[model samples]
Target: MKHLRYVPGLVARGAALAAALAAAGLPLVAAAQDLRGPLGAAPAAPAAPAGPRNMSESVAAVVNDEIISTYDLAQRMRLLIATSGVQPTQENLPQFQREALISLIDERLQLQELRRVEKERKINIVADEEDVDRQLGELAQQSNLRPEAFVTALRGQGINPDTLREQIRAEISWRRWIQGYYGSRLRIGEDQVTLVQQRLAAAASKPQYQVSEVFIDANRVGGMQAATAGAQQLVQQLQQGAPFPAVARQFSAAATAATGGDAGWVSPGEMPPEVDAALEQLRPGQLSAPIPVRDGVYIVYLRDKRGGAGGTLVNLKQAAVALPQGATPGDEAAARVKLEAIRTQATGCNDLEAVAGRAQGVVAGDLGEAEVSDLIPAFQEAANQLQVGQISQPVRSPAGLHVLAVCGKRAAGAAQLDREQIENRLYGQQLSMIARRAMRDLRNSATIETR
Candidate 1:
């Protein structure tokens, strides 16, 4: 399953919902406030003291008449700390408690809905124990531990592993329920898919980014200030070596949250304007700071980037002589002499190894294969100038002096958009919009009290 991650620009929900969907890292998404509203104003229980405190079975809050026990809230806090790798401290404890409480309340609401649907509709979307175990095993695998060992680690941290299990259960059930309820009703016509394809083809000339994201929804977290603070806390944990995917799965509100926020290859203008701008400044492996836009805060990680329309792919071999950075004219002359001599004996790339081996202080081997435009400027010029199986005059670069051999060249095509993928993206987006509205309606109609 695609795990309910949303697509952007597929279905027309309200602008805010569309923007929220777009903000996440999904295949195709067109992709805040003070902390003084109900959630922020709702008093959270005091943070339990460090270490194992006495268990309290008293009510923490009531959601639609379903009780959220203080014990439940505490367990979830421990679970959040264990999974998110966020430190539980006096300063951050209240924040953690609030987040945990909200999570618990949401779960209660979801379970309530699931129960209502199953009873009234006679449809069982409830995830069985086996389903929970399967998810648990997958999560454990992500941590590079066996399920038993993963449970032990959580126990070691004084967290009840069952808390994590129950959370996973809710997630699975909710995902199933949403998909079942809305999947059939949403439709993507051939025309819609074609339109997306046309858009993708038109944008093929723009740079594309392989990105992953973590979106903190301001409304869900209480307000803009609260979301920002939470984002900063998450960022701190990320910088300290917490895994991005794991944290995203636990905390990000985007549909991509299920798949660790991998957006795949997104062209310019695909992401929200602020996110797109942030991506422009990010290099591969770099993580952006929390970017506040109209609807939420986004933290993007650029996995890679590539030029538009692709380029000529080439294979080559080289013979080179190393020179220090500050090499004098005399040193350059000497290195050139060595490479020129090697070039004569090396009739083609086939002779690169043996001919260069005969020269003193020379290094030679295949330079591998890569797109011409992706190469360094010096190499790009050399590859373009040289013919297949031909050797070039000595070239000077920052590395040293080199004689290049062009072994092969081929035109690489840009990635073409797929119709099925486009259709699926659109369908997923519609379902996501429906799910959001359904949840909102549920929250609005339900009687809820928080303490």
Candidate 2:
């Protein structure tokens, strides 16, 4: 099942609820800075933007009775730019606007459907202030900022917290509606769980792929041509640095769209043949083009993979020297010598940071709990050979030399699945299909006007 059920707590994947979802790598703005990627107050006169004029634009889009004004459009753009940390050049702004407009349109459709469902069922699904607060708190945690400070930062960026709240409300409300309506009928027999266990046990030694998904529903289109074109555009935007999770949250018709399209760790047999073939062609951090299937177009991002199923995850730290600009082979050689010396001195995990501090251009920090495949190839190999409290010899990369230490490791296995886990698995599989159909019907009936 698609894992899009996380409430506002998921900032990125954890960010699943936040706008510009999955914005962990993006720096948050300060209380005083206006949304321009860390630039502070300016006394100097601002230069004119050297591009085609987009000023004087009016209402950008309309969904049913709701209007998204030019300011709303601009604010949304600024919010995306601010939170994503992906600066839009003149070259890509038009494309960004197109995708952004599409996303906003989809957001409206989702919220509208949520409202309609509530009215139809005589349910009150409004997101209260407390719900908004919790959502903000989760988003702040992803950026390592306090919730109040995060709110202040967002306001500084001209992004209304209420807009974020509405998004959260929509996410939460729609999920509740799906569960309330279909969850009762969604069931997993004990026999089904046993069958899955037997299959997994048999294939325990085979490779498993950890993946996230972005599905564009072409089946809803009046024509396959238009759907194909829309899917292609999404592929282009993702290639151009749009956050996959954010796009999924805004536009995916799948239920896991709520969790930012996280499908969790899927094995070869679990995935469709078309998807498996596509997965074979990409490595970790790579995305596939739109793979046209019978019902929709799928663009999958490979998170990581392993030779076997779940294994030990380690808490790791690294101490490294950042090579100076224009450093030569001799300079690299000197850095490696220093790293080896540091390696001996930083033999223990606790000593790693201090050893790095003594070296020039060395930056030391934690790598967090992660699997071997989660690291770069060289680091993965070196880590696999090390024991807890053991420090690696200098690992070389273009940036510089590095030494790593393993703080701890823990087992992660298939036995972790309990009855509740099995039920959720069943729920998600059924819910995604139901959610997709519901969204399709909603879109089919909606009156959307684009400028």
Candidate 3:
């Protein structure tokens, strides 16, 4: 029941490609326009192209006789910008492109590895298009739009949703391939789970950080100097309002980079003394200076923190009727009317979910379990008095009017959190380590050439 914010970073790495061109002072094939579509107003483009012809025909990088065409990189960048809200400005473009190229290289290596392993084992990686369709529909729903309208909106912005599809495919395929290739080996023993559970119990009442990281590996040829420079640029890019998740996707060597470098709710004691002290000095939404850690340098983003985390972990479901941006009096009135009808008709989570399904610009979702300290002070105070099966009066946020129903709540205890959560976290770290090593090995063994 962790209140985790999930921002899939696989496609965000695609934005890294344009970063390559920018770093080299090369212009993009086309100037990025005022893009307002599915995600938001995307950033501008990179350097202008060499000529009129499509860069798709031009080679960007070559891998084992395989080609990553310029067209691929350009389209990937556009889609990533459209989705992740990362802007590509002149100053940051080069750095972004450099990171993109690296991600692209890693992606190419992964695809190659997946295919080779598939062929050797006589296995197929099946990712149903239906799943993609479902995901697309769900994404469209988040914006309070229909699936086809969402695609049309993206098309209007010159962003192709297919690029997103391919990115999702790569993630799906890589996960399936890894699971198939290393099935039982990923499992944790009972003793290991118990130890993890014990640690959680001991650290349950300490200060915790919602941390994200961008890591630059010094193990490569140029050593610490080159790596430090990379970290410096990454920090600057982030400071300039680049989405941390996208940058992390493009640059982090750790497995968490796959999920935007999210190291969910780490207690202060869990962090190294240097990292812990660095975090202690910062407030939420601030970045740390590049910290040297063994073979690499890490730039951490402190997202949120808790001071002595003892509290109720409340789980609530909300049905919100969102007014359009720049809503007029009439729009607010209409939204209020709709919300009133919904509030009266919906008495439980299932009922509210139905109302959300039928109402446009409505959101029906579990707010995730959060410590009482984590909730906004006002909302926390209001929710504190409610028992299970109780609903709160409409709370006004800028987005719209929300009616929240307490789905469940409990005092923090070992039993409230299960073994699976701990196991998955452990397994994810293990998988990420293995994946990075596998990718490194593939790069070492492969004949890669850049154009």
Candidate 4:
């Protein structure tokens, strides 16, 4: 059954009634100052020291009338640290914990607002069984695990499957509410889309200059002065006709230093704003004076600029084979063999399904047509190598193994956008900003209790 899940404490009738009454300037049952005290101030120090023995039951703060347990906050912090791959130490753990707590408070607020909105609108958002099943299937496929294995993984993480499902359902319900309330009013006119297209085209047409640079690290001992000296010295060498790549390979600390810091052709938006600004003033073969970035100094020299707008129309085709959960190592081997057979027999996308079927696999999906750069590195390489109607060898990706065929190709040139497209893009930007503000306000007004 569809359920409307309310965040505890924030969803109570008394809380909602109190908020309405407060907004209407009614006298409070208790001192307004007492209730408002914690709203803007830093959290009070814990009554006792937080250590292993006391940590589980510690009260970090009270949100409205609810307590935020220290253990819950710690669990969230650990998850965040794991996902970000950051090592938590004594120096950083406190900061991380604080940030995690704030995030929890924000989430609670959002959930509360979702509940309030649902009540006001008299809507019951339910998660259909089919939707739940589909989601679980997808999750299993992603983890390369069977349903049972995936459930075990969740259990190992100390997560309850029912709680996780409830969270997902709540999120879905809130999204539906947002769409019903504001989706129609969100307008993206043609003019905005056209403007965006024009900008994209203009950017594409601009000459792309490849450059090599060296940044002297300033954070190490004697680093700032050494980098500064190195920048001046490198600039003099460039003026003396020393090769930029040679100097970059010898001195730059960046990853590209090995290749003489050869930053491939970059357009305006492709670089940091400061770098883009500097590049604008530089002509081909010109070198810049020392440019300072964070904790370093850079010596840059322009290598070459080439290419104007209009690139070729590359027709890219892909056949993906999605493996279902419970597929073992044997299943993976079978999938690969099947893909190879399809590749051997395929002439074009038209032959994909038949070939796949013969091999006991399926044409799981298509990526349709794509620009070369729009594809991932492996797919891009395969696509670029293929001739029209030629099928590629099966390649593995995170999504699955794919066989590509290039159906068509086009060369680069100048293109312009019509007016309608411009307006729509602009409208999208405006709507995004509006939505952010609305969500922020909703959060600020919510009586969130985190426990």
Top lDDT: which candidate number?
Answer: 1
In candidate 1, which residue pairs clash? Answer: 5-255, 8-28, 8-29, 8-30, 22-31, 31-271, 31-272, 33-224
Number of the candidate with higher lDDT, 3 or 4 = 3
The deviation in Å at residue 32 for candidate 4 is: 39
lDDT of all the models against the reference? 0.70, 0.65, 0.65, 0.53
TM-score quality measure for candidate 3: 0.60
lDDT of 2 at 379: 84
Clashes (candidate 4): 30
Tell me the TM-score of model 4: 0.42
Once fitted onto the true fold, the runs of candidate 2 whose alpha carbons sit more than 4 angstroms away are 1-57, 83-85, 90-95, 110-122, 141-148, 190-205, 219-262, 283-286, 308-420
Report lDDT (Cα) of residue 39, candidate 4: 32
Point out the worst 10-residue segment of candidate 1 by lDDT. Answer: 26-35
For model 1, state the Cα shift of residue 386 in Å.
Answer: 2.3
- The alpha-carbon RMSD values of the candidates against the true structure, listed in the order shown, are 8.8, 10.7, 13.5, 20.4
Q: What are the per-residue Cα lDDT tens digits for candidate 3 across 1-451?
A: 2212222346334333323222322222333432211123233333322123343256667888887665556555555444333555655445444544565676678778887777888877745698667666666666556777666655554555675666666666666666556544666777987987777678777666789987777753237887888888778767777778766775677666766777767765555677888988988888999988777888999998765547677888887877656878887777777777777888776677787678776778888777777787556865797777776777666677777878787765333248777766667666665665666688889888766
lDDT of 2 by residue, 204-285 (tens): 7566778888766665544456556666766777888877776676445555665777888876666668988898788888
- Model 3 regions lying over 4 Å from their true place: 1-8, 11-56, 126-137, 160-162, 197-206, 215-227, 243-261, 307-418
